[model samples]
Target: MSSVPKALKYSKTHEWVREEDDTVIIGITDHAQTMLGDLVYVELPELEFSFEMGQECAVIESVKAAADIYCPISGEVVEINELLLDNPQLINEDPYGKGWLLRLRPFENDFKELLTAEQYTKLVASEAH
Candidate 1:
């Protein structure tokens, strides 16, 4: 079973978002890291870059495969996790914590489009079955 933090909002694509004032902290969900299998490299978008909702913003390469990281909402990138450059496996170790990817200032409060923990768990379960 994958770890799902109650405080975060999740996208179907497996990105998690934590709202902090006007900025949202983003990262791949535990389920995502498990599926990717041992992260090796992470390609992050430049700060100040703007992306539409569902736009591919980054790429995470693991021993099993490479996965695209999508923006959960339209936003401008504010910050990125530089530590991941040295330890990509932090995503596998603590996805919800030290593995966070970037921060974004959203265009709107459309976070409701994201899945809840219960919904995400069902989605993952269905995928497994």
Candidate 2:
């Protein structure tokens, strides 16, 4: 089973969001990295670029395939994981921790509306069928 942190909100596209003081942290789920196989490269969004909710903001390339990473909420990208440029495998190692992708200053905390752990679990389960 994929590790879905109960504290984080998840997108249907498989990204996870963790709310901080005024900004939110983002990453692909454990399940995402597993499905992508061993990640080899990650193309991140420009720092300070603004993205709308559900917008494609980055690309993660793996031995298996390349997957697009989307913004879960409308926001300005305040920071990006530059280290991934040199070490994309960090995603496969610790996706919810050091593998985090970006930080966003959201227009609003609409992430509250995203799927919860239970909801996402069901979604993943349904997809497997």
Question: Cα RMSD to native, each candidate?
Answer: 0.7, 0.7
Against the true structure, candidate 2 reaches a TM-score of: 0.97
TM-score of each: 0.97, 0.97
On the 0 to 100 scale, the lDDT of residue 55 in model 2 is: 91
CA lDDT of 88 in candidate 1? 99
Off by over 4 Å in 1: none
For candidate 2, the per-residue lDDT at 118 reads 90
Per-residue lDDT over 1-129 for candidate 1, one digit per residue giving the tens place of the 0 to 100 score: 888888889999999999998899999999999888999999999999999999999999998898999999889999999999999999999999999999999999999899988898889999998
Model 2 C-alpha lDDT per residue in residues 56-116, reported as the tens digit of each score: 9999999889999888989999999999999999999999999999999999868776999
Q: Candidate 2, which ten residues in sequence have the lowest lDDT sum?
A: 108-117
Checking candidate 1 for backbone clashes, the offending pairs are none
Tell me the spans in candidate 2 whose CA falls farther than 4 Å from its real position: none
